[model samples]
Target: MTWNYAYSQDLWPAMISVASTIFLGFYSWNRRNVPGAKAFAIGCLFAMLWAIGTSLEIAAMDFSTKIYWMKFHALWQIPTVTALSCFFIEYAGLGRFLTRRNLVLLSIPALLVFSLMVTNNYHQLIWTSFELEEYVVAKYGIGTWVSIGYANLLGLVNLFALLRLAIRSSRSRWPVAIMLFGQISGRFMYVIDSLYNHIFSPGESVLVVIGLSCSLYAFALFHFRVLDPILLARTIVIEQMSDGMLVLDMQGHIVDINPAATEIFNRPASSLCGRAIVEMMPSDSGIEVQPGKIELTKFEINLGLGDAARYYSLGLTHLLDKSGEALGYLLLLHNTTEQRRSHELLLDKQRVVATLQERERLARELHDSIGQVLGYISMQAQTAQNWAVAGNTGKTVPILSRLSEVAQEAHADVRESIFSLRAGMESEWSFLHALRKYLDHYHTSFDIDTELLLPEELSEDILNPDVGIQVMRVIQEALTNARKHGGAHKVKVVFVEEDGYVIISISDDGIGFNQADLILEVGKHFGLTFMRERMTQIGGSVIIESQPGSGTTVVLDVPIGT
Candidate 1:
């Protein structure tokens, strides 16, 4: 059957579609350079191009004949698909700087399917021949069973491309689902019409139906701005990337530096850029920047903060022009001081732990062997003294003399003290130092009032280590608990040793809940449970008291005398 050669109501839609699409294409292109107006203009242009191209194909062909329209439709359809694909990527929030890598990757299945169509219809290319209908062109090429197969294959590939964009956009919170939706519905109707006409009876007019569908889709696309969200999201994500990126001109001036690079150096991009990186980096950092090549340089640049001693990994490279000559430098600054510090800290902790373990072993051996022997010797000396005082003069003389000799040996062992294991006067100061050191917040984010009440002493003791560690842990937990649940502002902390007990009070003035159940279920919070376990090992207890409005107080008490 042949479609009638007339500009009917059905072709009217195609004409309007083409006109609007071309108008959008030009307007969008013109506004491309406008900041903030780019995505909208681009989307309009995409729709416009598809409309204009499809319209021109229909205008040249007889709409009522399947064979004629089919012959030329592929040429028009390809550009529309290309435009849609580009629109999908941009509309789905890949940003204007979308990598060529991803684009090539997505084109694979489309290329393969197009290849299959060409291979199957060897003499006819992807589309074999055309059948014309009223206001539409339908292709009838493949043999009956293979016709279904080819159509299915085409459908799958088109759907795949669409779904890929939809999923990527979904992940980024950009609602480009409409693009996927429009592609599937518009293409599916056209495919079904071709298939139905080829093997079965002539059914619904696809172009007329799809033209109506496209009108609806275009309406939805332009009105709801269903593909509009991706552009805004691109703005947000680019503002948060790890590596430093700077876009510059032909001169050796700076364009921009991300937040990470700003922190790596002392100054913001506003202050540092356009002023040259030479004045910014440290003199001793062994960095020398010149034009025309990429350079990997290490630097000890002082970021003038509380942590002024830190260093960074400086990556300086020339921004190349199309011909590979240096236009400007793209400097990437990464801080490596933390990595170095962390490595050193691990080694130091390992050594200290090993030394402590060795001392523990020696202390155990001394207490078991020499201490027991000394106690036995003292017992024997007392026995001999008793006999000497009982008036067996001649018999007791040898015994009394031997007792004195044995007593002197016992006294020598007593003089050989293991004070290293205990908290000496120096250990108190060391405890304070250690506690203060642990409390140090490096790149920390928390809001809480911390106070330290320590004595005037530098000492070390086994009981002190045990008590001090448990007390500090309890205070840490209490502070965390207050911040998490109490909703309080002021927190008071106190530490003291009296009556052979080390006592600590961590109180917070916040909305204290009657967490009677939570206290009962303290074993649930692993941190809290571990804390209680730590205190228990040191012969201590952690007590929590709270009332709804008043606030909360946690007291950790440890017995020093065992």
Candidate 2:
């Protein structure tokens, strides 16, 4: 392997190509973080290698030195083509194809071509023969044709990718077009040099084409910012949004729909477009789309029947042109199916808790009232039996009489408990309405006159369901005690608002008791204890005003917003 050097006119263009490619390689390497930039840098490196080898081959005087350099330059062409193909593939947003397995597959042909070029001296598979005139010329062999075909295959793929990108992107069209022109011109020059070697020598052609291509690449990279990320347009935003979007013409016909809308409707865009907006809605959706009738509207809609139904919050607004003229309507549908299901589940859990609470309250009432009464009756019967057996008939008769009275009171308590358990507010019934109904029933059942007084500005919406139920139970207990224990003939219930509080006063025309006796009486009478506990649960308080001779009054102090 003897080496020799001589001056040649081709050296200038080859050196220029080397410098230009080296600059492009480093420039692209600086932006390697950008998509496709690393691959482009690698391609520039291979192009630089080809330029260096071509320059050395042009300066070599001996045929043997020239042939060796030619082989080196030819070997680099395979890798350069492969690297550029990878760049275009990534730039076209198809980088998924560049998996490790696919990269290995892509490199197989380059490795095979390299092996054939290296062993060409033994088999002459790359260049059958070489002739040295002013430039080294070679006759192509089967291996050379194979390498050419493989390179052209990759070149076509790169061209298709760039062309697709140019067509699809309006903002990057100019940059893509410039790169496409560079690729086409480089390939065209190679083809011309291959066909007409007398007019265009291989070394000069390769250097000139590499320099031209690198200049075009630099222009696209610096002047047009080709490697920078593309800004999202309104259409791109609409297309990629999670919420479904529909654009309808002024006549309420669908003009365009995004992929999300297509998925929501479970139909293709072609079918959805040119159709009336109402035609796609479920029959019971309750959505009315009247064009120009309203400036903006919103409502919830159910799209399917039974368990498969999906809920969406649909918003409609007029799409206006720059001149303020109504162009069409923009319908935005946000899926709320999960939220609706969550709300229903929450209500179910609440109902379970309410039912459990009601059962516990009933259990407490039975234990405090009926359980104590039954125990007292059992003890009184045993005492009466002992008195009768000892021949003390006078004491036994009074004990038996007292037992009968206790039995009657227990029966009345049972009835009252049943009534309280059965009393409930209907969905449409207000707290005041339920209270009035209970009072009417009490008057008819007990023959006790009842009167209700309410403030004029009282609102039914003031009390929530839980507060209303607790208040009603407390009032019922007070009215029952006024009749049974106090022996009241008439009751007056008054509702008055004072200082952000609703004070309920129940006055009874009944025998009064000493205020000092309430502590001892509360232990014996669970009704009074239960009333205080109920009010306390709802952030309220109960006060009893009474004397030995005057009528009694029960006052409840309840906060307005509780």
Candidate 3:
């Protein structure tokens, strides 16, 4: 009910527009983890504030009914321009690959233009405000579109940059492109119309809203993949590979074995518990068990391998401990199926080479040991046997005072034979055979059946060195505790799938104690405490359930990120 030109009807839209923009700004600020989310959101903050500031002039005019054009709403154009400019840069990816020099050069345009617009707004540059007949009209200056032709020009540059980034990233750009199309095209049209007259003054905010929602939709679609990118990629490659791949831990237990590996070994991963590498390969080149970043020779098995006649060039690398011991080996096998013909000829050549090596080892052994021992037999026959066991029998010259060599020839022959056997076996059998043998010994010694469950798909996720060792540790601790504390008849361990987690359970019908009571008393054994700590260190939680005379159940649930 105010007088003419006093209360502008457009004030309501101004408030609502700015308030919505500010809300978006605050929402994006809180979600800082999202990439590029801050850019548009931050720009919206300034845009909203400036929008409110611009509308305040309407209130001032309502109070004073001022005819002064430069009094109130006019000053707001500066901040609005500044906010939108920055927003455009981020949404368009204009700053992504921008050099420092390029940015510095770009800043110069704003300095020269912003001041010019503020001082002479009604005449030149992006827009010019002219007076129409009465009603205090502001007409468009020449080439003035959306009150800022220069602003739109800069915006186009930003949009093009964003388009390029979306295209070049080799990523899904459908969602982003949809968002940009809605935002940039809508804004472009508005800017073009504004140059002619007051055609599309403020309706472009609707398209801006659409753009934000599309971006959020895109983020939701892509978030889970970011957590475990390699797992998804592994699934794609598992079936495609031709060569066999087997992964194992330090204890020679199966971590993950591919379809080809299972076919070659005639066993699934679960059945090959603690199996030694020697049992499968049983070749001279398979004994190197050191972990971390090693290139080992391919294991050759000659039960007359038909199609697998070619040598496999194996690359073995180890993860290490801080004390510099091998933690585990990463095994990669390159199939050299095309080289078996060449290899047969090479093997013939290798036999000749080995004959030379054998002569040298014997000569060195005699020169370094047996011949010396025979000479020293008169001096120290009793002492030579003791010296050989000490691994330094050849370190000293024949002793002069107490020549006590005991059965020196026999002792030297035994030592030489043992060394040769170890060297031969080290190259012959792999860890798989050893692991299976160890598990067999455990079953025989403890009279407990150990069960292993494996997944159908052998994956890099399951084969990771840290993860495999942790699983083994969990199993080891659970078994040790069951044997020590749980006075039960039968021990059962079941691995099941639950809520994207690999669930493990160890339980026995032992004399159970109240877990809650024992924890409260602090007087019980530290075994449970140690187990709990180990589980906690690996980002997994352990639950213990027990009662007086009932069996105890220990559950460890681990996430595999598959």
Tens-place lDDT digits, model 2, residues 18-37 = 99989888987887877788
Model 2 residue 353 distance off true place after TM-score fit, in angstroms: 4.0
After superposing candidate 3, which stretches have Cα over 4 Å from the reference? 1-10, 29-42, 53-104, 121-137, 142-149, 168-175, 200-361, 364-562
Model 3 vs. true fold: TM: 0.37
Window of ten residues with lowest summed lDDT in model 1: 416-425
The most accurate candidate by lDDT is: 2
Q: Candidate 2: deviation at residue 518, Å? A: 6.1
Q: What TM-score does prediction 1 earn?
A: 0.33
Candidate 1 lDDT, 1-562, residue by residue in tens:
4444434344556566556555555644554543323544444454444444344444444443433343333333433454444554454434464467865754564455446554644655345554444434344444423434543554465456556544432232233354445556766665566555533222223234334445554565556544344644454454466655554434435555655666565466557566555565566555554553334455445444565566556565666679987676666655667787898899699659746754664576466546766777677767766877896667767766776776665554343233222222243444555555434430032445556665545234524544564455556556656765677666776677777776778788899877676768754555456457657866788887888998998888878654
Greater TM-score among 2 and 3 belongs to: 2
**How many clashes does each candidate structure show, in the order listed?**
33, 0, 47
Candidate 2 C-alpha error for residue 375, in Å: 7.4
- Candidate 2: which pairs clash? none
